[model samples]
Target chain A: MLQTLPTEAALADAPPKPILQLVGVRKTFGSFAAVENIDLDVREGEFLTIVGPSGSGKTTLLRMLAGMDTPSEGNITLHGELINDVPPNKRPTCLVFQSLALFPHKSVGENIAFPLKVKGVDAAARKARALELMRIVRLPESYHDKNVMKCSGGERQRVALARALAYDPEVLFFDEPLSAIDYKLKKTLEKELKDLHRETGKTFIYITHSLEEAMVMSDRIGVMRAGRLVQVGTPEEIYGAPVDRFVCEFVGEVNTIRVKRGPDGLWSGVDVPGSFKVAPPQDGAALDEAFVVVRPEFMRFLGPGESADNRLEGTVYNEYSLGSRIQYQVRVEAKGGEKVMLVELSRARALPPGADPHVTLGWDAADAFTLES
Target chain B: MAITHKRRDAAIWGWTLFVLVVVYLPIACGALASFNKSRYFGFPVKQYSTDWWGKTVDSIEIGMIVKTSISVALLVTVFSVVIATFGALAFARYDWKGRRLYQKLILLPIFFPQPVLGLAMLLGFNAVGIQTSWMTAVFAHMVWIVPVVTLVIAIQVYGFDPSLEEAAFDLGCSRLQVLREVTLPLLWPGIWSGMLFAFLLSWSNFPLSLYTTGADSTIPEWLYAKMVAGYTPMVPALGTMATLGAAALLLAGGLVGMLVRRRATA
Candidate 1:
């Protein structure tokens, strides 16, 4: 085993070369920069998502990559060739817009086969390929002749997907196409999109503000704030290890206890009892002052004789039933003031109704991570 | 409360009918005069005959006037629709500096009195040593009609999704291809309505054509001249034909509009 280590290490070291690369790209309108300098490598055949709130430059970045807008600074390369100034029509890329943008005047087949038709393909071949794409997208064969406007919202989404695939682009860009979809259908489409990415082996760059949506489909997630990229990681890394308070709170419900190291070499919390046990910060920053970030599900309710690294008592102000699990909103009275924290539990382990409002919430030092302010 | 609603509804319908009759009374009178046996129009016809209608239909002079009116209307419609389609897109779709000022300036012509506008144009043409004819009348009509048609098309342009054109461009269509394939088809309904307005306004116009068409006369101009020259039974017969022609064109335009909408959404 020791003799084979070099060969195995060589095999494990192989990484996919990027199909598209951006370096120090910035876009501005007049004096206002819509997207700041950015560096990213989109691996070949991977699903990458950019997630941020409105005006966070997610759309601006997607537009630049899609060839709809040019970067004011730096270079965008496709397959090691500069394509920074190529217009969208000449670029081997396609964008599925936020509105889906189906041609209201065309039938489903015409809409799907538009790019093929633009290539001057014969009518029969265009129709044949459109039908094949429709099958790939799982749209019914009968919908080929139906007007696009007559289709339901979910059907329209399938048509848009088929149209984008018809172009046979090297990379596909999606600008929040599922944002307008209803909840139940959005969930189904998210899974179907992930499966489609696997089947096609084509690069997909998707943008949305919903982190949950990004987590379901992306191989890598890039979190954007203001006009800059805050962090880039896999879904597990983004959820487990955020960079700062913005990204930490953005992930979801969490219990944050701000703490400062004392002269005696012990960490003391400012929000609660000032005795929090925290792991070192992930970024390797000085940990003199930091926040202990623990997800709600990692929190435990300490009963009589139960033990944990740190414990805090708080009043249960509200309880929410989240299907198989439940969450409690607790208000902890601390040295500074009262701070709200969320604790979750499975249904079988739920706290009983009419119980005492005050309870102890506990967690191990290993279950929580620390972040520098 | 039910009785009050019934009474109010009756009053509304009564007012509507009264207004309709008052508006259409001149056309009805003209129709009656066309069939009257007497040479001059008189209330309560003693007899009815098709003699005036036969004479008006066979007259070459009247035919020339009708042809002239149609040619001017067609020319005006074509020019106005082309100009207004671009105008509407710029007004409501594209974002540019001073767009608000451009919109306000484009609509200013619609507020001017038509006769005064006509007189000013006639004087300008005369000062330039340009002779007036039916061709000049077409231009005169277009000056007013293009702005009105632009306003009509802008309402539809305001609702158009700009992303549709962008999507087409992204899907491998060139700029001109995107315009021909997506932009024109989406704006077709508005263009059709603008065509109807341009044609009808040019067809029935009197003041502008009166000043501009000096050597070449249209139906309205000819009718006014004949009425001032002397009364003839053919005048009312010709007026009745003009009214019927306009009504038929309007009905045909409405049917075409309905069919186009159905096919688009079908």
Candidate 2:
């Protein structure tokens, strides 16, 4: 079943077996279910990110995986050994908190060396390890004697990561550690975190609401919605080929054209005046009605003598510059009502400033995939 | 507008100074009169002497009362701080049935009339055949001081971030280690202030000590007895010592709190 996945085929060889497995795990708080019947396998040394909106149970699942909270049912195993009953301190895993939770009363070195101190490591050795970890996290040596509270938000985040690493756990869990940081710093930390993961070779299980962060760092992304793991795959698989409308919309901006099958077994756009060519369903199921999902970047303005599998006439009402790319909102009159289609193009390929407002937008059939709505 | 705002600030400062003098003048006068040569506590003393201070040290009865007060206060402070800190930790960290009711009940003694509470405790001790000694006074003092300590510590506990404990545990520390290394260190200011309050309250309490101390009279009860018999500069000397002692404790507590806060922020 896994052989059909593009990610699996692209791998150098058969990927390593999972180091941790969660089978039918469920957690309930009284009558309310925080996480329900979640099954996942975490490959050794792989960076996996679970992305979801708030209250979607991503944190609940991470808590159970980190051993801070026990599952109400099912089993969790590490290296094929059942560990559902283990407490966080007894387990070989550490969780970096959303708030970082660095000790304000202690210096940065002392905070990082706390785990070592608990293991009864001597003073000299602890200091050496702490300094080494500070370097690994790109923190200055002078910060070792400074109090954790004096450090800026991003610096505190690095201190927290260094502390979590000091535990030398088999797996490290992160609970939106970058949510409190500014955008510019978050971007830097995101790349640094991916580099750190590669350097450490430890399994990283991170949870966040930012799919962009997941796309940037995760080897595989798990999309969660309402206490359930809706889909789990590589970033390319999640973004280019989402399983449903929810996954497609959650990942990035998408344009969906509703299409219905005609008596001749050809799919026709239900709203627009003409039929639209769409790629066959990836699942190979014959569908009477489906949504043709096309990303904004895939849809472009057709030039003179240019052709595509599907084309529609629309008036370009507004255009927005998003750094290197320009997004155009084209209003098209359909049989049902007026519809707006988003088209994005690079700055170099953007329409001329004085171009006619009435334009033809088109996308190749191969660039758009069909999914049952 | 700026000139009027400056004038308003000056007026506020003047009123504050006036209120401070009004509130503290009597205590300052009493402290000063302790060094006067005259037996009566009259203003505009003719001469000053250390005779009353010397008398306090020389008197055996007064010495024993001071010893009793010190011992009782120490015992009450230790017991109250330990019990209250544990209670506050439980209240801060967990939710259980009747938690609010238990919290209210623990703090109930703070609002009770001290004389009535002392009387009820004395009666209860008599029914139980327990003799009223310095230990009895310590127990009575605990009843009043424990709630205050708990309330003070609980505010700090409430402000504390529980995630620090979780982080500690995640870093391979046991529950006991987390409490010892993280929770208690962060709560040092609250514990220090609570201990000071407990000791001060127990040492200075008069009404509660009146009924609880039978054979072993505390300093406050002894001083009250002396006041009833006659007026003396020695009484003022004792008051001066007590006031100085309390002021020293407050100063020490403040200094420690400031130092802790500075270290935390540094």
- Each model's TM-score? 0.96, 0.96
- Residue runs of model 1 more than 4 Å from their true location after superposition: A1-12, A280-285
Q: Residue by residue across B1-266, what tens digits does model 1's lDDT show?
A: 99999999999999999999999998889899889998888889999999999999999999999999999999999999999999999999989999999999999989889899899999999999989999989989988899999999998888789999999999999888998999989898888889899999999999899889879999998889989997788988999898889889989999999999998788
RMSD score of candidate 2 (Å): 2.5
lDDT of 1 by residue, A1-373 (tens): 2232222124338867889999999999999998999999888988899999999999999999988899999899999999999999998999999999999999999999999988899999999999999999999999999999999999999999999999999999999999988999999999999899989999999999999999888888899998899998877778888888788788787888777886766677776775776655452236688777889999978998999987988899999999999999999887657889899999999998788888999998778888876
Q: Say which docking band candidate 2 falls in.
A: high
Q: List the residue pairs that clash in candidate 2.
A: none
In model 2, the runs with Cα more than 4 Å from the true position are A1-6, A10-15, A281-285, B260-266
Looking at model 2, residue A207 earns an lDDT score of: 96
Provide DockQ values for all models, in the order shown. 0.87, 0.81
